[model samples]
Target: MSNRAPLSNKEIKTRFEAALMGNYGLPAVPIASGSGVRVTDADGNVYLDMIGGIAVSTVGHGHPRYVEAIADQAAALAHTSNLYLHRGEVELAEKLLELVEARGKVFLCNSGTEANEAAVKLVLKAGKPYGRTKIVATENSFHGRSLGALAITGKAAIREPFAPFGVEAEFVPYGDARALAAAVDASTAAVFLEPTQGESGVHPATTDYLKAARRITSENGAALVLDEIQSGFGRTGAWFAHHAAAITPDVVTLAKGLAGGVPIGATIGVGKWGDVFGPGDHGSTFGGNPIACAAALAVIGVVEDEGLFENVLALGERLEANLADHPAVTEVRGKALWRGIGLAGADSAAVCDALAARGVLANPVRPDTIRIAPPLTITAEDVDLFCDILKDVLSTAPEGPNHE
Candidate 1:
């Protein structure tokens, strides 16, 4: 609306390097605008968005209903601190509980890390009365960047630098029932786990593993906290990835796709744990903003109305069948669109760059793994196009340095 001119990709990168922190590195692609599942970069190149803003764009980019809901909410009312209640927040919380199918309370926050922090407090407080202090998490599990969430995250590189996180945490091999059982004991206050590990490549836990975790934590009087930041909100073709296990965790932290890319996070405490957080224990100023809640409501409505779950299942089946049999792919892991493609011999990072150059966007979650978490709104044709592009890229990709 002003006299400012749009910056080109080079200019954007220059400014980014000059002003921003190097934590993420300068973005390879400077996206200018997006429509549906496609994004146009500052260089005027169009790309099929497979990453979905790292699995945050639930309803796809610029969805009509989602846009309208956000606009309407913003125009009507925006921020009202935690001092007074609003309909959007209350309705969103109620809807979350209903979808979770649990009788509990919802603590709204701004990000997955904050949600986990609230959960950490709840579990620690619950255990304080009984002298329980330890927390058990899974190896390679990614919760968030916050110190509290980082303390429970089992990855060494990111969590180690900030020593003395104040939270006593233990790590166990993911999906190992015996290891988990061995790690959790009377002194354990909580067990934090992801239904599907997304960052270190999307690896889903078996039903037996999750059920065993539930049993073990319950027996040890430890709160079973499921971090569904990336795996929840229909990413696994279910409302929650943990639903497949048929076990209700005491605490579930949700974010990412919760608000169709709008910043929102939720911590649901099931049963008695919901009442654990009393006055002044925890809160967020912009946690339950009406705009984000409205966006979330719209996303949920669109997902149900359009039957995206069935679409996700159908596309998942199609994608797995195609990718798993590809000559360049060794294996495909994960559920629905949240897939991690194991490259047979190609370097995943190089392959992703090639894919991007050819107009498809994906994530190299590991050196040999390509993770795709496309939006649910994409059509069958979109999947076919992605498959074709990926096939072309991988076919021409060079062998990785580690290739035998």
Candidate 2:
């Protein structure tokens, strides 16, 4: 390593702002190093990581086993495109199918958006024979920013500027079976819904709503697509949040936590829907790269061997229980490790900043909602510390929104 002083946090942010696009604006902190469930900033201050790279760091930062897998795979083989067959890519696909407890075909990509884009193709093909082209999504639901996925994404603000989305879609109110049943019909190619709305404050769908969607899609010759990109890979104390719904979906999208911070996405098509795509339908040059597949395999192995799913359940319960009595908290949304806090009257931005000042990292997902999706490998001490710091921040949380 070079024996030179590192850049300060402010300097790093300045360079990033100057060089990078303004899409994300300025970062809150410049993280230098991380391990397990903690990260140290460029300023040498350490923090308990509750955001977990927006739920992407599943096995936590710098996990020895995960590191070894990626290193070993890279040393042996890394990129092979889709032309040549590789062990990791094939194995990862099988593992994903097994995790979903379904017999299917897998399409690998590099992010949640890509996976959703593949899903759009899968549903389109499935419905093409019936002369269907429209997809059904829900209000306040976020699919991705890609043209195809954005069409199914129900957020009007983001979809407005990018008008004329690739695929046409119908938007229904989330958790409303009547609206969903009414919106979906023979002309509908597929019904896409999140098991739990992640970007929209971590809202979960009701049992009846999901059941209705399954029934409606089945009857209408439309595929039921579950967007589990945020809720899959044990984030919600289950292999996939839809598993708890006791219903099998025709298509499912996965990413975010799949490779534990390594970019990887998957679209799993169950039964007949798996055979939708023939050659030349779609392709990704770097999709299912050996290194990413190896990392995903390592993550699944670690989650199973260490029982991270159960840990998530326990940790989630503890968090919800601990924060329930806080004066500033009104309600907690989501399940397992994927949680969102609804502030009583305090502003979420202030609470997030306050928590950051107190050595904990979280995301203010909405004006009144704070999101927490820590590494599943966090220890009891980590949870306790986060709870204590969160409570303290809430006690002194700013009253109103002050983005300035």
Candidate 3:
């Protein structure tokens, strides 16, 4: 008998397209299960996932502690609306504050977009009564795809069609301190930016720039909001990427890896920003789902008790060092497990397909940029294998991604 399962990729795709929306079109394979950094397809082919669910799987797939936390939480008590409070929700919020080493208030939500939306609402509502209206964001920065987040998102192709974005926001060059300062004024409610630009190819914000934003926002009484959805939670060497800048922002949005793949997001407000919202301001139905909170708590515990931060630093150093010297790679940006690769003469899409063919999974975040956000728990051997496969894909290619 054959080792491969009876199911085929075409069969799965057909059924999936029939029942699901057209947004994702069709995935490469139907994943049945995953362990550590690898996933097994329905047809039983195993592939190493380097994207880590786009940076959502912090502790890797099917981590024992993460699994137990969700299972235990569900087995006990599951969903409770915001009208009612739960231990998991409270504890998760407290843990978030502790991890950042800042005094803040937290409102949990379902995803990264939702967290950005909530943060926007907090800013808009707070500023409305105070005569502040405009929000400042940087070019090439991606907050989320939701309406409000889309408004603040700096990508024109995605946001233009969805124009009349409802929110008043100004876009400036990402790293230019002067351009950013000029864009903000007394009427500006907030300045939203990513500590490291992930969607526009993993560009890191300079520490001086972060400090300037912090200083300008403080001087002008506008909120400085750092979108850490991708760079937070040990994805970077530190617990949070902004910690490297050694500056604090007014409001910080978090998601993606918060619950180690569980769907959860959080909007954290520091000091006065924390008190911006009052009763009946905002809420979420399945935001702080007990299972999600339990999962987040477990991820945090494991990250701390097991000293994953130190590992992230070491592994990040290794990944950057190994990939930077590649001839085809023009630049390596971002920190730790989250990185963006600038391809010299390869179609990132074709490279991704080639990687998939070679039993590795990654994403073409941009046409010329390949993003690798593997699980934090991935071993040194995994990094070596990924780099080796990528080098092979580049060398053996007949032409760029558009050709063979």
Candidate 4:
């Protein structure tokens, strides 16, 4: 481990501000230790973690099983590179493919961006010789910040700066089958979409729209790529949100919760598209490291053994029902534990701040939309506590500028 002395929150913040580039805009609270759904700040003030590290800590913080898995893997063998095959990597790949019924194979990486980047390259390579170059993506959809993923991402503000690296892609309104059908043609290489748009305020794609994408992509000989980076691994109560839509994407991008906070990403291709990439086409040095794969296997095991999906379904219903009656809340959208609450006149960021102050951690996707996606392993008491705190915050919050 890297040697460094622990400092107070203020000291840490000061050092971070001085050294790091200003991009994330500085975090308000500096957290120290965390367990389950609770995290303690430098001052020892505990807050219920509703965001789950932006939906990455699927099994909650410091899960014993995950910890043990990592410890065991470290003791046995940490890494052997991609040159020699490792059992943990093969097991993880098999498990993921079995879960999704993906026909081809799995390519592991480090983050959501890398997974999407790999998918983009694979689609481009496969669609070539057929003259399929244009990629169709939905408006408000976020792939990643990398050049390839950013090129296909929908947000014009995020994409405009990197226009030089932009690919031949078209944008269409999300959840609109007609628009997607119109956008995709024979020349389109792939149609990429998030199962549930997490960064764009937890907007879920309609089942009809997903079905339409599959149909259109198939007809046009374009690969259908579903980005489940934020909604996979029981975050949506189902194994994947696309399962609810009753459609199978040609390629699926996964990350965030796959390894229960461990940095890991996977791109699973289905059918003949899996063979698009030859052995020498793509590779990663630390992609399928044993430690990460071990962590993922443990996460998967715990999710299955603990029946966390059922918990997600039950608690999600309660959360949605409790928030729906709030006068300040305009809409609650999403399935299972992944939900977004739209406030009527309150600023979403202000509401999140208030929740944080009241010992509950939540985040705002926009001025009007606040997303609630706690860990799937969160208890009934946790949901009830969050609801109570939210109710109190909503009751006392002052009306702000209604930007939405």
Best by TM-score: 1
Measured on C-alpha atoms, candidate 3 has an lDDT of 0.90
* Candidate 4 per-residue C-alpha lDDT over 38-65 given as tens digits, one digit per residue, 9 for 90 to 100: 9999878899999998888899988998
Better of 1 and 4 by lDDT: 1
Q: Largest lDDT belongs to which candidate?
A: 1
Worst 10 residues of 4 by lDDT: 395-404
Score each candidate by Cα lDDT: 0.92, 0.90, 0.90, 0.89
**Which is superior by TM-score, 1 or 4?**
1
As for TM-score, the candidate ahead, 1 or 2, is 1
Q: Over the stretch 230-262, how does candidate 1's per-residue lDDT look in tens digits?
A: 999999999999999999999999999999888
Q: For each candidate, how many residue pairs have backbone atoms clashing (under 3 Å)?
A: 0, 0, 0, 0
TM-score of each: 0.98, 0.97, 0.96, 0.97
Q: Clashing residue pairs, candidate 2? A: none
In the range 181-255, model 3's lDDT, one tens digit per residue, is 899999999999899999998999899999999999999999999999999999886778899889988899999
State which candidate, 3 or 4, has the greater TM-score: 4
State the local distance difference test value for candidate 2: 0.90
In candidate 2, what are the lDDT values of residues 1-404, reduced to their tens digit? 67887999999998998899999989898999998999999999999999999999999999999999999999999899988879889899998889899998999999999999999988887778788999989999999999999988988999889989768889999999988888887789999999999999999987777888899988988899999999998889998988887999999999999999999999999988889999999899989999999999999999999988888899888888888778777788898889988887788888888888889999999998999998999987788888898888888777866323
